[model samples]
Target: MLKITHNTISEYLSNRTFSSIEKIQKENNNKKYLLLLSFLLLLFIVVQFLPWTQNIQAKGEIVSRFPDQGPQTVQTIIGGRIEKWYVKEGDQIKKGDTLVFLSEVKSEYFDPNLIQRTQEQLNAKDLSIGAYENKVSAIENQARALEQALIIKKNQTQNKLVQAKNKIEIENAELQNINKNNQIAQNQYQRIRSLYQKGLKTLSELQEKELKYQETLAKVSIQQNKLNNAQNEYYNLELELSAIERDYSEKIAKANSDKQSALSQSLEGRAESAKLRSSVSNYSQRQKMYYVTAPQDGYVSSLISTGIGQTLKEGEEIARIVPDKNNIVAQFKLSPQDIPLVSKEGKVRMRFDGWPSLVISGWPETSTGVFEGHVIAIDQFLTSDGYYRVLVQPNDKYKPWPIELRMGTGTQGFFLLKTVPVWYEIWRQLNGFPADYYREDSPETKKK
Candidate 1:
């Protein structure tokens, strides 16, 4: 019985030991899975603390740095039919190089000798102006001659008046002497008659006194008549002087009127000539316009008006030219919320459409096939597509852009901003918050 009891105890112990070993093995296997899960959790927490570069992504197209350096359309200002083509698509040309020759399409400019005919008209007007000028000059000379004649005639009339006045004075003196002689003869004749009556004088003496008295009376009458004639001659000289002044005045007035009329006509002719001259200049310039020239040195990209003999209206586009291609830039549009985050001189990473690239959004150092650039400009106004525009250019401190880059090529740009921990970035994104705003000179950025 003792032996059987001991054996049973041993068997029981052995079974318990085996069961415990199995349970231990199962626990160890479960611990192995738990340890792996804990290790993965710790690794994820550490990765969340890693640095991440915050960036804004935008799609854009390559363009010229300047508007004038971009593709431009060539146009004409006058209506015409294309006569000949001096250049074709893809031809490189300099400024002022003729691209096309055109012929007049309007009737007003159809004359083959339009400029020459206009010039002839201008010349004829010039001749008319010259003739009027000469007429004005001749009229002026005539007026001056009339004035001189008036002065000379007035002087001659004045001289005649002086002579007449002198003659009147002489005649008046002779009349006074005759009157005195008559008085004396009258007195002697009376005395002779008294003597004859008293018989104290002879008949011959009385007769002689009578005859002398008569002769004195005749002399006085003749002297008075001469004085009257001299006075009449002075009056006639005054009238002739007045007539000379009146006649010359009329002549001078007529001459001055003629001069003024000629001057007016000359001025009118000059005005007409000025109009003709303007027309001639316009025609000459129009003739030059027949040859459409390049506006700048460029390659002809396309021809809008192609066929010879095709008619084009005024201000019609003729062709397109692509100017310098060296100054290429990327134009990107950003949302309104992103405008405040973008600034001039901000760093950017770009991936061209045709180039293969592997992008790690938060790890720029790990990115491949991406080019570096910087913000050169930002638009103050919203674009037509309801977004703000930003301009990015190649960063000189980075690798040069691909030479195969062409204008209008598609580009994807990443505008880099402040750096932060991956956890914070993820948290901010979860909360719909903007990236942390930091100035370029901030200590936090400098520390990075």
Candidate 2:
């Protein structure tokens, strides 16, 4: 129990009162500081709600339209050494115009019947014993080969006969004309000779007419000789072709007889050779298909420096042809960050490389010296140069298009993403950020 004085009590109460008042003042100052800090934070957050524009910048070039199949890369269908070139660079050509010719390559035709025939002969070899098996089989193969050879030769000779006859017909027409001219010259020479004798024409004139008559006669004989030669060729080919056919038939019959004998003997060798003449004929026609022709009406823009005698692989590009049609696509490159913002439906604003980049950084709506475009597509992956690819088409919505547009011209594209509050963008920039969420959501909802 401490004794209490009235004055001491009053002094102690005064001191305690002073202490309480100081503590209250300190607490109020702390509250004021906290209130000021909170107000500043609120101001920063509210500022993020202001409007801002965001866009992706990219560089690219104008390219042929995808619908036109783009610029064509003409390639060879068959692999062979180039034999001839029909079109030069910059030459306009129609569809089916031959551009390149390749050397003809030999091809073998499949024949099942010949194989069966050979097998029959080989089976027949079994009865002759082991010593003659190889010999018999070889002979059978040789006979089969010879048979095919004779058939091919007969066909070739027949073709030759037809060609020779056609030549003879042509020569006969020429010979008829030559004979008429010769008769005219002879008549003229007789008249000149009579005139010379009657003293109406000089000896020099008569001699000249005689020489003309002889020359015409010589021409007639020459024409007749050509016709006779053609006729002789036709006759010889016809005879040779007949002989080959007869020999081929006999050999085939003998081979069949031998095979019948060998079936009892029971030895065989397999020969897979041409039994179908259709395949052979088709291959012969294809041999002429070594020439590469233009797929459509186009102009030869360029060709490989490799010329005649240079071997090209199948599907190898020999030249490039630009079609007469016009369809243009602006091709451009994007960065990895810009890829997500671009969509097929999204719009693009392009400033051609030659065209000024009249692009104001923040406000694309007020863009000048730029053209409107619609996004076409985005590439599956980045290019080798670490840039992504994006295709866009000209919108031409704002005004009439510029006249200087062309393929392969460089372009700078502004890939517009979305509109968001400037305040939100600043806040996002301060931290890490997601895409503009304000524009992604509805206006009323965002406001709420």
Model 2 Cα lDDT, one tens digit per residue, 1-448: 4667444556455634688877887899999999999999999777667556777777788877655545688887767788889999999999999998888443332342443454454444433445445555766886788788987888899889889989999999999999999999999999999989999999999999999999999999899999999999889988898888898888877876775565434432222112223344555555656878898887998997357888787778999988776667678877776576677867777787666656774577777888878887779987899887777877867554466666778888777777778766667778977565344366855687
The count of backbone overlaps in candidate 2 is 13
The local distance difference test score of each candidate is 0.91, 0.75
TM-score of model 1 vs. true structure? 0.73
Off by over 4 Å in 1: 1-51, 94-98, 117-128, 162-239, 264-281, 324-326, 361-366, 383-385, 437-448
Q: How close to the true structure is residue 333 of candidate 1, measured as C-alpha lDDT?
A: 96
Instruction: Work out the TM-score per prediction.
Output: 0.73, 0.44
Q: What's model 1's overall lDDT? A: 0.91
What's the true lDDT of residue 357 in model 1? 98
The superposed Cα distance between candidate 1 and the true structure at residue 372, in angstroms, equals 3.8
Model 2: CA > 4 A from native: 1-52, 64-68, 79-83, 103-278, 309-316, 380-387, 396-407, 419-448
For candidate 1, write residues 249-355 as lDDT tens digits.
Answer: 99989988888888898898889888888988899899899999998998999999998899999999999998745589999999999999998999999999999
